[model samples]
Every structure is written in structure tokens, then in C-alpha cells.
Target: MTTPASHLMTSLRSGNATAPRLTWYGPDSERVELSGRVLDNWVAKTSNLLQDELDAAPGMRLKLDLPAHWKSMVWALAAWQVGLETVLDGADADFLVTAATDPVEGRYDAVIAVALPALAMRWPGTLPAGWVDYAAEVRSHGDVFMAHAEPDPAACAIRAGGGGVHSQAGLLEGFALPHEDGARIHLAAGDGLEGALAGALGAWQRDGSVVLTAPEVELTDHLLATERIHGN
Candidate 1:
């Protein structure tokens, strides 16, 4: 079956691949932009890591404990591409991805620590024992993803906290926020990871772009004009 992840990736890599697909504004005057091709590469590499290194497969659950950052978005896409169910409600999961400096051990089969900085090559400080360093490890993975096992469309895709569950095939239909085609949408980090992911899915599905602002970063008029934002 053509899983939602595979379909979405195909769309992302098609036509005008150099167009900016995701742009992020963060604290300390940080700005990161990723074109469609680049975004797809990141997602593919992360998916490879999940599938090859962590042995992630369909029907398994992976909890994303990070905030609404670009890296978090990549993780979500990677998990889905690997056919792992994304758990947003802090539910018990087979794997855990977090930015926490000292994540509790043995709770999950594997733990991945993510660094929020766009240019970070590795975790700033000493990495917790038994934890995978995303920045340090992801680059070694393949840039193209080929699923070893097909995903079940009828399986649960997202376990949204208090928002209920969505099947793999119905994830985008259920959670994607409506937007105009090719629109540049702005997202606030305060909306949480779930909201950001949903908004991103909505925008990308429409061949649009997303501009996400961190909590401390104000969405100024200059930013809106520069990013050519058409909707929120």
C-alpha cells in the first residue's frame, strides 16, 4: 500500500524542489530555511536512522518529547516514514526522542537526544549514557529512504494527546489544517508540537511553505513580509 509518508515524500520531491518548504525563526536571531529537496533529505536520513539503527518498524510507537522546533518536525516525519506510530500524549512507547539533558534510562527501547540549534554538529554537553545523539549520528545515514516493510494504512498513525487517534491513511485528512494552495503559512511555537506538525502537514500537502516562530521570537511585520506569509 502507498502509505501517507511515501505519498507525501513523493509530492515534496516533485516540481520546484529548490523552493523553500520550511522556514524557522528562533531565539537569538536564529533563522533556518530548508528547501523542498533539503527537507526531504533530512526526513529520509532520519528515517534511515530509525529503520536501520533503531530497528524501528511498522506498528511500533515512538514518543516525541521535544518542543515545536524544526528538528522535532523532522523527527515526526521520520517516524511516520518508518511506519512507527507517533505518540504525542506522553504515552508508553517503544522509543523516545527528547531534548532533555538527562533523560531517564530503560523506559524505552532506545532514546534519542536532539539538539535544537540548526547548526549543531552534536550535543553541546556530555551526552547521557545509552542515548543516541541525533546531530552526531544522523549525517552518517542514507539520504534516500526505502521502506524495508510496507506500512499498514489501517494502523494508528498519531496518538494525539486528548485529541484522539488517527489512522495512518487518514492522518492528513484528519489533522491537516486547511490552507490555500501554494500559500506561505505562519505558525506559532506556542501552539505546541501537535499543532505545528498539523500545520506543516497542511501546508506541505498543498505544495505550500511554512514559517514557524519560536515562543520568544516575535512574528514581526518585517518577518511576515520577508517570508511572504499568506496565512496563519
Candidate 2:
């Protein structure tokens, strides 16, 4: 299997276009982009962190709270960089608040959220804080991108849902495949489609591309009501 770095370098050399990647902002700001130099630096920093994690703990689960925007590609890639299974919860911060408390899905390391969507974030850690700015930290890292670890698919990835978390065989089945046409995006369940930077967008960004479903407004509204009623 070709490494992500080699694949990214090939795409960059070819000058491909990619979907935008998203990052959660402060409590007030909406999602923001982490492309260009910002993206380079993130890839550089997170790449090292991921390698360190793999070195310390070979099979640890990683949880990310991301939205469906082009910018989300960065975090997804970063997660894959460390071989962490990015739990795909098609809900927002409000939804996570309940998931975290529930007996089944409550053991996440961290979740990513932005603006109003962050209504689900009552949890805190290095990933998400009760009252903190993640973007500022990304900026503090600077413009140099660095890393040495390669993508290891043999590692575990768990997709958590209401009943219980399941093995991410769907991932091993192949989410991105190299084709004569180019990098192809594959998604089985509808949940994998959001903010997945695939096809043209991914090629340009030198990031993994995605073919995801559009966002759902009703779901977000439902999370809000649940949070309001439950007092999250």
C-alpha cells in the first residue's frame, strides 16, 4: 500500500484540487479553514503526535468531533496519520454531551466542535475544553510542517453508535482507492460522507478526498432541543 505522504506528494506534484478542510473555532465563531500554511503546520505537528501515540500505545482509540465541511479533511487525515479510529457521530456537540453520559458511548478521549454546533461539548481534555480556543493553539505551532510516521491501517478504528461500537472493517474494505482515473472515494453508510474532502477538492489540497452526504439541519435542531431539555 502506498503511504499517505507519498500519495499526498504525488497529488501535490500533480497540482490537484481538494475539498476544503474544517476546524472547530471558539464557542462563538463558526467552523474555519486550516488550509495553506495553516494546514501544513498542523500536518507537521499532529504527525509527530500521532507517531508518538503509536509508539507508546499501539491500539488506542481516538475520538474526533468534526463537522461536514471541506476543512474537516485535515483532522481526519491527522487521525489516520496516527492510526486512530475516528468515531463518526453524525451529531453535533449537543449530541455528544448525551453520548458521553450514556453507559455505552461515553468513553471518548476528545471531540471536535465549532460555534453553535458546540452545544454538545460539556466534556473537556486536550481535544476540547469547556472554555478554550483550539484554533489559537494551532496558530501558535507556526508555519513549518513536520512528521516521520507512516499510515498504519492494521491499527484499530471503532465506529461508536447507540447499541455499541463496532469494528471499522468498512475502513479496511477501502475508503480511498488508487485508480487510473485518480483517488476514488468510497462510503457505505451515509455518515462517512459529510465534510469528506474527496475528488477534486482533495487532489488540490494534497489531502485525502471524500464523497460524503450533505449536512442535516433537523438533526442539529434535535440536538439543541435535547440539550436544552436535559440541561447540557
Candidate 3:
């Protein structure tokens, strides 16, 4: 077995090749954060496919266009096996097609994305023409996925539910503050405008949940959900 020093040397020598990470995910997840959950799953799949990708091609990179709801610990490890970078390509296909235009972009011949069917339909050309259906493949994959890279970081989440959400004006003020200066924030106000803070604008390490009214982030209520009770 490799000793601690051996492992440390191995990691230090080729850290870039073995360091894992979650490049993208959703914002303001109430519990474990649905977006973070998907990220975790993706990491798992990538890790499982890492050796496979490596055996097929020694030096290659994987570029991902992940939806807001895609996060998996597995995806990160798998990336380290090769080199995977995460990118957020809005919620549309028009942009995605354009993203694969250049040679560097072309290098990302493979793709991992959610809503593959919808995306496939939107593509001007054909499905799997030069892309790998990430979500679809993941759904078909086994539940148990292993890792080959080191832990980048675990994701934590906080959300302000709609129970306290009320209408005064016509906008969504969101329920949580973006947190301290270094806080993670994803600002999104979708559908039900009565009151909803779509996401955070910073990273995913922010704490507590704060809910504002319809027109102002300042004029809102306060709430915190615990795992046992206050479940979403």
C-alpha cells in the first residue's frame, strides 16, 4: 500500500491531474441543494468514466455545459482523470451550438448536459453527431459511482421558502441575503413573481436564509429550515 508520504508526493507531483472540483451548480438550494446534488452525481459518473476516457485518450480535456440543476461529486473526480472544465451555457441551445464553434471548443467534442432531449431537438444538426448525451447517459448508468480524484470541496445550501412570501408590489425580492462580502449568490426570479429569490450570486457556501417581500430585499421576513422539520 502507498504510505502517506507516497500519496502526498503523488498528489503534489501531479496535483493538477488529480485535483477534483465542481465547476457549476444551482443556487439557493434549500436542503442539500438540488443543483449540488446533480453536481455530485455528475462527478461520480465522470470518475467512473475517467479510466475509460484515459485508456481511450491519454491527454484530453472535457468541457461541460451544465444546467443549473446539475451537480455531482463524481463529475469533479472524473475531470481530474483528464481535465474537465465546467461552463454554464444559459438555458438555451442557440448559445450551446455557438459555443462549439472554435478549435478549442471543438476539442470538447463530448458534452454533458441535462435536458438532452430538449437540447437534441433544438440542435440545428443531429443528436450525438459529435456530442455525448450526459444526462441521458447518467440516467441509464448504475447508481453506484466511484472516484479517482481528490475532494475539491463539499457543497452546502440555504433557502428561504415561500411560506412567508407575500405580495406588496410586482417584483420578487427573494428571501435570503447574499451573505457576507465573500458570500455565494445566484439571483434568479422565475415564474411565480409573488415572491421568490431564484438563486445566489456568489459561491454555495453562504449561510442562513433571508426572505424579502415582492419589491425589496430589505423589507422581508426571516426563516431557517432544519432537516427534521421545516422540510421543503
Candidate 4:
């Protein structure tokens, strides 16, 4: 099978346009739903920024030290599309994508910070020198990305350390969580990137939507029913 990142694009191209692909529930009851087409637009713009602006290419390492917000998924998909090895908090990387709340002192060639709050639009304060505001700059990039070259599935796509490397193919191999098509998988933000990856990839590969939640928010039956959730 093709990588989930690739399959996701195929799904979008094949007319999975208006369906909710990801629904994020943030702290303070913030909610956002992105359809496949909208999600693709974000990914494409992000990919364009990564490739065109940052000079990202195959074999470069891009660290994602972001929270389990919807934008994190966009960054991940964009990195994968460019064939950058996406790692979790791996200090040694060509690029580091994180939230504005994270420490900005790093040696990365490029730093992209995202503001996780809903409706925040842009980073509130002046960022450290050389850091890019994702929300602000991403909008300027084109909505379509044409990679200079094809990604190699056998190459490392994600590295969480522990002497293991998840290739593009491996990461795409859904985390084995059970759910039917269109199931809304709920994940807690406190679960972090690893937890989000497990649930998101699994649900996404199975033609299901994900509902990421903040730990503080209660997942009531009403919320589940209202969100059309099928799993947690």
C-alpha cells in the first residue's frame, strides 16, 4: 500500500472533498473541523513553504515539537510530502516546527512556530530572531505544492528515537485501533504527539475522522453524539 500521506492526497484527488477529515476540540471548548479539501489546501501551502522557503528536500530532518492540535497534523503531512524525516523533539534537525510556547533557543536552520489557540490567527509576541510565524507566512504560499521529486517510502519518515525509524510506509500503517469508516476517534491533547499519531493515523487510514480533545474538557455523551463520534 502507498503511504498514508500519499493515500490522503489520493483520497482528496478522488473526490473525498467535503467530508470532515479532522475535527479538533481545544481547551475552553474551542472547536474546528476541516474537510479533506481544506486540509489538503493547508498541507499544500505548508509543503510549499517548507520546500520553497526553507529549501527542505528529501533526507532533511524536520522535528515536530508541537501539541496535538489540528495544525500539527498539517505540519506532519507537509513534512512527509516533502520527504523530510519527521522526528519528535529531536534536537538535531534541519528545521524545527513547534508552538510559540516552546523555548525558541535552538540551532535549527529554520524554526516555525504555530499558535495553538483557536482564532488567535498569529503569534502574539515578537518571536526569537530567525523564527517564522507559521500562521502568518503559510497563508502567503501557494495552495498547490509540486515536490521537486518523489519521496522514497523506504527512507526514514519519522524517528522517535529508541533506535527505531518509522519509514513513510510504516507510519502510514495505521496504529491498529479499531473503528469503522466515518468513526470519530477522540484523543486527548495531553496524550501529546505520540498519542495523537496513533489515533489520527489509524482513524485517517480507515476513512474515519478524528476528534482531538484537550484533557481538561469533559467528553460527554452529548458532545460525542453532537460530534458524531464513534470511538474514543
Top TM-score hit: 1
Ranked by lDDT from best down, the candidates are 1, 4, 2, 3
Per-residue lDDT for 1-232 in model 1, tens only?
A: 9777778887888788999999999999999999988999999999999999999999999999899999899999888888889988757999999998764744799999998999999999997788899999999999999999998999989977676788889878887778888989999998999999999999899889999999999888988888899964
- Candidate 3: C-alpha lDDT: 0.30
lDDT tens digits, residue span 1-232, model 4: 3455777666864566888888887777788989888888989999999999999988799888887779988898898888888888645888988875567565878988888886877798998777888878888999888888778878888765366667876676633355676677788888787668767777777778888887788889999889877764
Deviation from native of the Cα of residue 36 in model 3, angstroms: 6.3
Task: Give the distance in Å from residue 133's predicted Cα in candidate 4 to where it truly belongs.
Answer: 1.1
Preferred candidate (TM-score higher): 1 or 2: 1
Q: What is the C-alpha RMSD of each candidate to the true structure, in Å?
A: 1.2, 10.9, 14.6, 2.3
Which consecutive 10 residues in model 2 have the weakest lDDT in total? Answer: 93-102
> How many angstroms is residue 84 displaced in model 4 relative to the true structure, after the best TM-score fit?
0.9
Q: Candidate 4 lDDT (Cα, whole model)?
A: 0.79
lDDT top scorer? 1
User: What C-alpha lDDT do the candidate models reach, one value each?
Assistant: 0.89, 0.37, 0.30, 0.79
Candidate 2 displacement at residue 200 in angstroms: 7.6
lDDT of 3 by residue, 160-227 (tens): 24333211111112322334532322222222221222323112223222221111222112321221
User: Least lDDT summed over 10 consecutive residues: which range in candidate 1?
Assistant: 100-109
| Candidate 2 to native Cα RMSD, angstroms | 10.9
What TM-score, over all chains together, does every model reach? 0.97, 0.45, 0.35, 0.90
**CA lDDT, candidate 2, residue 202:** 39
Give lDDT: candidate 2, residue 112: 30
Q: Which parts of model 2 are misplaced by more than 4 Å? A: 13-42, 45-58, 90-132, 142-151, 157-173, 177-232
Clashes of 4: 0
